[model samples]
Target: MEVKDNVVIITGASSGIGLATAKLFAKNKSKVVLVARSKEKLDKLAVTLPNSLAIVCDMTNPHQIKKMIKKVLSNFGKIDVLINNAGQGYNSLLEEIELPKLRHIFDLDFVGPILAMQEVIPQMRKQGQGAIVNLSSGTTRMYLPGMSPYSSIKTALNVASHTSRLELAEDNIRVSLVYPYMTATDFEKNTLKSPRLSQSASENKDFGDLPPVDSPEKVAKMILKAVKTGKPEVFANPYLEKGELQV
Candidate 1:
């Protein structure tokens, strides 16, 4: 669970929680591998961190993930921690949501990480020790009107986290799930990218009111701390700590 000297792989590390965790790990003197679709961004970030490797990977593709795992194991020797955090949400009413868009959410938020896990776990298991940290949302505990699809897939991930934990524990591998409250990131921007949605909301569309969000950097720091301590679940914002915010 120590952050120092560990080889950590972070999916979706181009930005947001993934990027934050990469920077935190590098700062903690860990060897870090960052995976994302943006080559330029990953290159820039890799140059800034010592003992870090930036890999342009699309987790959705099984081939890309396989090659990524090959490149990591070849370069860094092994991965001690795998962070599955690349996901997007679909925030729309059930009636307005198209079937394709709904499926995309399930694929990205659930299937993508699962594929990455399947590819990397064997290497981790071969080493006889590893840790997995999954990114989840608080919407799993509450029904946010416009988030039916998003919450559904996220809940599926939460369930995967639990079952995967029990299954992987026998191998001396740890699985940790984090349900971070809304943070100031590109989550909504990514949500609007559902290909199945024929009619999209205007860029300025307002969704009445929602809970206040926090900074990605703040949440990223909390995420690293939680992982280092091996906590099963960590609330970076702890919005539910207050009675009114309870889900």
Candidate 2:
């Protein structure tokens, strides 16, 4: 689909990849709707971008997600794209992971994006075309010792996104997944660490060997490419040699 002048709503737009995506879409002349919990950051970004609106929203709340979609419809008339980028990181051993923290991460990483898709699908169906991109992690395909819980949640989203691609095909709503390797972002700083693990240990924990870290702008471009081509999958760093890295 053509991105110029299209209405695009991106959740978690306050910082990192979401923020970069919002700016890139704006630069391409799309009407960007920036969604996040940070009012100051969203407001600051909205004014700087042409034809942009910022809505403070907590993706974890179904009510808030619904309201955000409604607000986007109210302002833009039709929804062209929905980017599910709002999520948290969790790292803990299976035995050391706390139940409540695990539940919170599940809510943010899986449930929230699914709910947002539910709220946007009807509008996209009415319009007869749309694109949805869900941000996933490269770690999902790796067997990281302390990352199982987080990767499991992303794996669930991967399944849902792929399933939606098939189901929404009839509606002309394209659903895609973008896998990003380690990127320069505050993701690590905001990650929920296990109580049993010290701060330094969690920070210093290595993932064996990995590829070069990607930047937020690099992933943002892949996201834009996914929407423009309606490809089912896009990878930030394809050197992992995975067969799924096509497009």
Candidate 3:
């Protein structure tokens, strides 16, 4: 689980938690392949990090994901870590959703990660030891009214990670998940802004401020700690404080 010299592939690496994690990995001298649709951000990050591969990959597309995985493994020889950080979210009531947009969230949040996992697990198994860290949400633990689609899908992801860990454990592949509250990221401000969620969310704007959210860079450090330590999960909040966790 040592970070140094490991080849790690991180989806959604153009920004937010993914970007932060990429930088952290690079700082620790891990060769990192940064994946996302934005070539611009990826290129900039690569310029600053030695042994960083920035591939403009759209994870939702099966073919692109396969190509990206192949390219990374070819360049790095083995995939030591795969961090499933790319995802989408919806903010709306169940009744007011359009078919495609409704499905797109699950496609991005659930299906895309699974597809990426399917591609990488074999390589990880070959290595005889690897880790898959999934990025989930605190919304599944806490809640907000218009986040039904988001929270449900996020919950499903963690469940899948748990089951996946049990199945992959025999091969020495570790599956870990991270559940973080709202962190300051371009992700929220530039959300798909699904119209279906908007109409309902506007009326029920029940989003009262809770605890202060952390910066993505800070959250990413916690994720790296989990990666190095093989922790089952990391919660980016004081709520998982001293007295709250079960020993």
Question: How close is every model to the real structure, measured as TM-score?
Answer: 0.88, 0.94, 0.91
Candidate 3 wrongly placed segments (more than 4 Å):
193-209, 240-247
Candidate 2 local lDDT, 95-191, one digit each (tens): 8988999999999999999999999999999999999999999877777767778989999999999998999999999999999888888898888
When sorted by TM-score, best at the front, the candidate numbers are 2, 3, 1
At residue 128, candidate 3 shows an lDDT of 88
Q: Evaluated with TM-score, which candidate comes out highest?
A: 2
lDDT tens readout by residue for model 3, 186-230: 766555555655545333555475576689888888889778877
| Candidate 1 lDDT by residue in tens digits, 90-207 | 8777777778878777877898889888877898899898888889888877776677888889888989988988899889788888777877778766675333342555345564
Angstrom error at residue 207, model 2: 5.6
Q: Give the whole-model CA lDDT for all candidates, comma-separated.
A: 0.81, 0.90, 0.83
1 versus 3: better TM-score goes to: 3
> In angstroms, how far off is 215's CA in candidate 2?
0.8
lDDT of 1 at 13: 90
Worst ten-residue run, lDDT, model 3? 238-247
Number of the top lDDT candidate: 2
